[model samples]
Target: MEDIHALIQKLDWDTSEAEQAEAIHKLQDIQDEELRLLLQPLGKEYWDGAAEVIVKLGYPSVKPILPGLLEWIQDMNWPGAGRIAPLLREIGDPLIPYIQDVFRNHSQDEEWMYWIFEMIIDYWDKDQIVQIQEELIRLTEGKIIALKALRTLWVHQIYSGESVLLLLEDKMQRSLTEIAQLEIAYPGIDCEALGRGFSEAIFTPELSRAYIEEHREEFNFCHRKSTLHDFVSEIEELVSECMGSGNAPA
Candidate 1:
């Protein structure tokens, strides 16, 4: 544990690159139960560098870290499932079942569920990603467990290049608008950040118009395109060009 302490003391963004790499390398070598123990609390905002130490330990580290992450979620510990999802993703596809089970068990915690979706984008293969898009669409079409689900689907649809507006109802549209206006720490997630595309996807002209139409007197619809159906058509064309002639995603 002294090694863990010494190595962690060296892990700072301000440190020299060589120092950072050396600390990470040494942390990776620990490769034991103690390393996993460090992962539990380190998964949070401050001690995340320690989490990276376990991440550097890679697949072998997965088995030990995962159970603790899930337990924290199940027990509603601080930071909870939302913080752990991306950390879990660092170990990749092996944790799919654990992630899936969380949705089944704690489906009502919406933001955490969406974080899980974002994590899959970095880890899962293309086919698995397709399945995620479909499942998210299905989830959005039904009674939502968390309002954030629509926003999650909205971003997935941007990449899927699918017509999200057509699949969604008025309520889902409102949910999307709410998230568009929500204060999020963009490029903030661990493993991989949400990126600029997510911001643009949520504020698409079509969704903006829907919000304006719903609350006509609330605000000006400055985002409205010259054609009422303009953004939808652009998205369709984009889908066709990107995916080729076939309606199915390539």
Candidate 2:
């Protein structure tokens, strides 16, 4: 363990790229279950190096250590914590099940779940991400992590906006409140992400028209009243264009 810790120290962020590469090479040379176990505890102390070694080991070789790695990264302040994101992304689809487990077991740990989503969720392939649609929707109820889920859905173009609205109305309501709180927490931060998400999720003429009609009062009540009303107007115009052309609502 002491020897492994020394190797990980050599991979610290302050080390030169060449030096880190050399350390990575040395660690990769001795990959095995024992070495992998020794590397786990060092994740907090030497994550920069430990994560690189795990990334190189790849797939099934590193699969058993994933839950531990997930736990290790809960502390964003840890050394080389940023590297853990890429490592999870490199592990790719194989990491999804473990992430789903985190969602199940740690549903109350919104901060940890939010960090996990921020670090790796957007980086995963769309096919892999869709595996957790239910969990993602559930996460929309989270005070800290809802924005991450909403952004992932918007970016990936998963589900119809109306469907997302119907299935996740209560949760989306909470997510909107969370977004407002986030704007307060970080003044001048871009809150238009919510608007963009709404646009992407509810683009169809029927869905847009129905949503505006049903939720117009809610939009009027929003803190950013003018911005949301403008969004509703855009949707209404799309509805009018479709109707003028004699296209049935879809």
Candidate 3:
């Protein structure tokens, strides 16, 4: 552990790229939290190395660092936002609140907010649908990012197609066509699958159900159903099959 700590201390963010890469690889072998924490300050200059450290530590080891990482999002000077986003992305829903809070507050620096919003729409508590709706309104604000966010929400069913259609009622035809085109162009590669998989692997059904209920509007849209009831029925059948098959939940 001391040797690991020494290696972390010796990590030079300004080092040659080869040296930095070597430090990152060496850091991946250390498992102690105190040692990990000792290396936390390195995140500022060695963002990639920090990310590798976090991933090496995994969730339990990294959990302690979350609050600090969340606080780092607001650090104007830290390039931690971009580096942290991928780590949080790797951590997935277990880190949802931290990600959501960043989006909720409109933390736009580093585009971390956008990344967080994308992750939440993909994997957060379905009950957060209302929050997602609010976020869509707040962050998107009619820009290209918003359009992209909206498309993400639509794909994940974070907002029901009806809700989105209603929101864009003024441009329904155009938006719907755009959404369909975007869906095919991008396919099912958004946060939804990741969220569902995380939910099944780490969360309870009740929690999963809450996520579903919160995002029923979006789910309804995915099924091409006009009503929530139809969507719910389909979800039940899917859930049953998933559980019976011993597949990863999603």
Best by TM-score: 2
For residue 85, give model 2's deviation from the true position in Å: 1.2
Tell me the lDDT of model 3 at 16.
76
lDDT of 1 by residue, 1-250 (tens): 3367667666655667788677777776675656554544432542445556655565655576675554543423344344455556565656666666666666676655655655544445554555455445445544433223444543334333244334433544554454445324222222112223334445688865564465442222222311223434443444444346332333
- The lDDT values for all models are 0.49, 0.64, 0.54
Which residue pairs clash in candidate 2? 161-201
Error of 2 at 59 (Å): 3.7
Q: Could you tell me which residue pairs clash in candidate 1?
A: none
Q: What is the TM-score of each candidate against the true structure?
A: 0.45, 0.55, 0.45
Sort by lDDT, best first: what order? 2, 3, 1
Task: Point out where model 1 deviates above 4 Å.
Answer: 12-21, 40-48, 67-92, 121-123, 126-250
What is the alpha-carbon RMSD of candidate 1 to the true structure?
A: 12.9
lDDT per residue for candidate 3 within 1-250, as digits (tens), equals 3366566655556677777666767766665556435334655565546655666556666776675665544443465455555555566556656655666665455355544455334554444544456656665454334544554565455654545444444344444555566567555554456457546744687767777777665554554423233433433443344345443322
Query: lDDT: which is higher, 2 or 3?
Result: 2
Tens digit per residue, CA lDDT, model 2, 1-250: 3365576778666788898788788776554555555344433545667777877776667666777777767877766566666777677777888999999788888767877876878677678878998898787655346546755665566744444344344544544565566556656433355455458658687877776676554444454544444434443443344445444223
Better of 2 and 3 by TM-score: 2
lDDT of 3 at 216: 64
